[model samples]
Target: MAGNSDPLTPRAKIAVTAGKAVAAASRAAGRGSGSVIGGRVALKLDPDLLARLAQNLDVVLVSATNGKTTTTRLIAEALRAAGPVVSNALGANMPAGITSALAGGSEARYGVIEVDEKYLAGVARDTDPKCIALLNLSRDQLDRAAETRMLAENWREGLAGSKAVIVANADDPLVVWAASSSANVIWVAAGQMWKDDAWSCPSCGGVMQRPGDDWFCGECGFRRPTPSWALSGDHVLDPHGSAWPIHLQLPGRANKANAASSAAVAAVFGVPPQVALERMYQVQAVAGRYDVVQFQGRDLRLLLAKNPAGWLETFSLIDPPPTPVILSVNARGADGTDTSWLWDVDYTRLTGHPICVIGDRKLDLAVRLEVANQQFQVCENLDQAVQLCPPGRIEVIANYTAFQDLRRRVGN
Candidate 1:
């Protein structure tokens, strides 16, 4: 409808037009980005709107418990080396949000979507993507979403006969099991830092034997696949054994792992590793993550860690001792309503820093910190939390809703 060369059906055109108007109204009212509500409206009007919108575009779907948004962003950037790309850049990865993104970028040659872990199969079905990148899977949104093994089974069943090339993480036993049914797959040895959720094999329910960089199930013989693409320290080793150094602006080993996966996905679309990585280096942030903002005369570096696995990776990105880390949390609908994940995080690693906790569920985190024997001060809000820290550079690690709240407060 916008600039798409392929004309939408009359009914689909009307639905998309109504969706765009609602989305614009949503933004104008300061409610939020109208992507979700707008897409919902469009779907209600025409049930097949998503598939219609995705027609004629080469699509790539990326799903994982962690790093999906950043990986989606990196893939979009890398694919730009080929042509214009459309993506849900604001971390809206559900059906409605994805529909809105596709509708808006009707003329783009590529559609790189960040599909939520629970919704991956459905999105994959509708988009019929050329490639699907499955990053590591772990427990996230446990109260609302399916368990890790169940999710893996869903993925394995959903992708059984798909023609799409799957770029999967071989380091995660769960992911390996999930993508095993696919006919064509490019295995990437993307490292998994949080191994708690995958200690058992999804294939046989046997205890997984992990030795160094290899994993195998002695009971079932379901071992780690030999990776065609591997992450070797700071370099990504291609199928030809050529090493390409990763020098992205984003920090942490997780982003490097994401880069490895993204490079592999980009290759499926005909973009070479060196060219994809060169273009990916231009992405400084995903949504509001890793954004450094000046607040209260101090530099506040924003980081989003929504679950146990995410927290483990985020801890590695924080500044070393005396930098004053602020931990914020919330039990909103988007945050899974369960504070139990806090207990799973290794708060003891934060023992040497000046820690401040604030959010609707600050007490839950405070109690968890107390149990970990790490001291923390609970504050009423972000302002109070920042006031407790001696200025310079402070790291603020927060869950989903709390991170958005802080972003609004800091005008980031």
Candidate 2:
């Protein structure tokens, strides 16, 4: 038992017990995906299961196109100062996953949940979170999610009725527009590396102008809000111009921005930036983001890049020129059946580097690289690719299912 026992109705209690049984059976069958199916069954048996579990809980809901899982993990770590915080540790962002996390941690009152962009409003309605953090929005799984602008518009309407204090990215035009109508908002300039999805104003359907570091609509008055908290390189800057240096075991500017966004949300609950940033530095790996493991007599660092925006940021973190890198991709159900998004990523950035292409979509990725005028070697498997790399740490970047396959092989 983890918070006080939830005050669930007798029927809801039966549903929870049944779901727990299903979860245990799934784990026993070597399908330990952390309550996904079990939670789904419970919710089907009782559609109001989440609302019941979330009672008397101070919950924080985090949503973004990228960095939702990592940001949720970072915020959970920082929120430890408040009390035990329950979260979807398995990268499950939907209602079932949220239910699983809540049911699994029955004794924890404080909670944080990473929500998929399209499902945020639904989950928020059920959970009634105390705070909502909006990171950057970009085109992801376009086959399934369609356009980023459409998603932002949905958020704007859905969030209008929410009472939660919103912590939003001031640099992202989409994020600014989504949370503009919130009753209370804490804006943070965590930086946006992907701007293709935010080129237009969602409000007026007009082109936006970026002068210096700020963006404003030419037709509408919508613009990038001045952040109460901003990130300056590795430093977290305050509204008064004072700054605190942030250290992270994870690499890249995107992660620094993720940390800054999490820190901003933590401040709303009385956790200071210095304390939050200190705890964040201790996170070397969130899920499979920056995990180094030995496989096939070679050490490898695992990084997940699901879409174009993610690949751009991951490539930026890789060392330049001839560093042995392994890029893997798959078009499984979890990775979206449409592999066309591969063409959207800038694979040319790795032109001069030694890259070994592997996975189910290896042919698709290879074709993309070839069309981009980049040179790469095709490998039969992950172990073979790792063996081809020079001795020592080989950076392995993989999409959804491909990364999971590697993790299982490495016993991670």
Candidate 3:
């Protein structure tokens, strides 16, 4: 395994120093955190910067269509029980971002990386992580990301061999199929709320027979593996059948599921379930996903939901009806150009709540809500939307860029 004593090449050392300079300049200019840009410059100068920086770190890479950022945060916190841990806690999942994070924390004992779904293979190859947590797979960024099954195939092939312990979600057939080829895997029955993408078997292209939680291929007999870790309502059951109540500051069942995966990965690093869960409980939010801030005299809760699967999960986290909900979306480079995924979401669930649509793509969302027979006002901006809502706590659910815009507006 790579260790901190392994010195970087002279070229890599220069690249690292230059990257820091660029990042500092970026932050000084208020252009955004300089992680991505800085990492890009470092990679341009020294292509092997990531592998060099990862030396001497017990790395853990977390990837999924949703919840990876939060799960990454939880796992990093849990691993801190062992020693100082470095992580890309700012939602920077790409190579450039991951490189910046690793370079910044050169002396940290562990690296907990939140990897973008498509870049998992490359990052894993470079980091040689001690543990790789594969959460559920689903359709996201349709215009940019690969098809759901194709990405599964990429994961299956990319991780065909090697020694990293694979912590996978058994509840997701896509995840199970991808991780099955690995020799060392700890399967967790992490709940998969959005099942639209896994109706067929990735193994044989046959119809999947999901009788309750157990799933199998009708043609090839590919079946869901018995999970060593499972979620039992409000508690997570370990391989020994001991149940641990998940009391987290992060709301919703999705977060509880993330806790299960994080605990499993933390265990690989010698952090027991009791200690891991206790450490994870401290993470109240991930990159401002569920942050609440006072805006225009009303408490505005920011919730991020980028894809259809994400939208389903975000809806469950909203404050109950009569508490007005603001839905915002944007079709920017960050948030895939395609807006068709909006139709896949069951927006009727928001019918009872006072709804307001605002964002670059608010008109597109308004049409979807209209089709769902949900009455909503199209606001030009968040200020106007908040002005119409009654005083007190209000929910604001937004996609990628829209969420960032709202976070900036609220100064969160």
Expressed as tens digits, the lDDT of each residue in 50-166 for candidate 1 is 888887789999999999999999999999999889999997899999999999986699999999988888988998888999998888886898999999999999999998999
lDDT at position 43, candidate 2: 95
* Comparison by TM-score, 1 against 2, better one: 1
Q: Name the weakest run of 10 consecutive residues (lDDT summed) in model 2.
A: 1-10
lDDT of 3 at 203: 92
Q: Which pairs of residues collide in candidate 1?
A: none
Give each model's whole-structure lDDT.
0.92, 0.87, 0.91
Which 10 consecutive residues of model 1 have the lowest summed lDDT? 1-10
For all candidates, the clash counts are 0, 3, 3
Misplaced by over 4 Å in model 1 are: 1-7
Query: Which prediction has more favorable lDDT, 2 or 3?
Result: 3
What does the lDDT come to for candidate 1? 0.92
lDDT of 3: 0.91
lDDT for each residue of candidate 2 in 1-412, tens digit (9 for 90 to 100) = 1246556998888888888899989989998674889899899989999999988578999999899999999999998877788999778888898898888777676789999999988888998888999998887775688588888888888999798989999999988988987888999999888777888888898999988788999897988888899989889986677798889998999989988888888888888888999998878898877898877777788999988899999999987777789999988888888998887888888887888999998999999999999878899998788777876578899998999998998999
lDDT of 3 at 345: 99
- Evaluated at residue 37, the lDDT of candidate 1 is 95
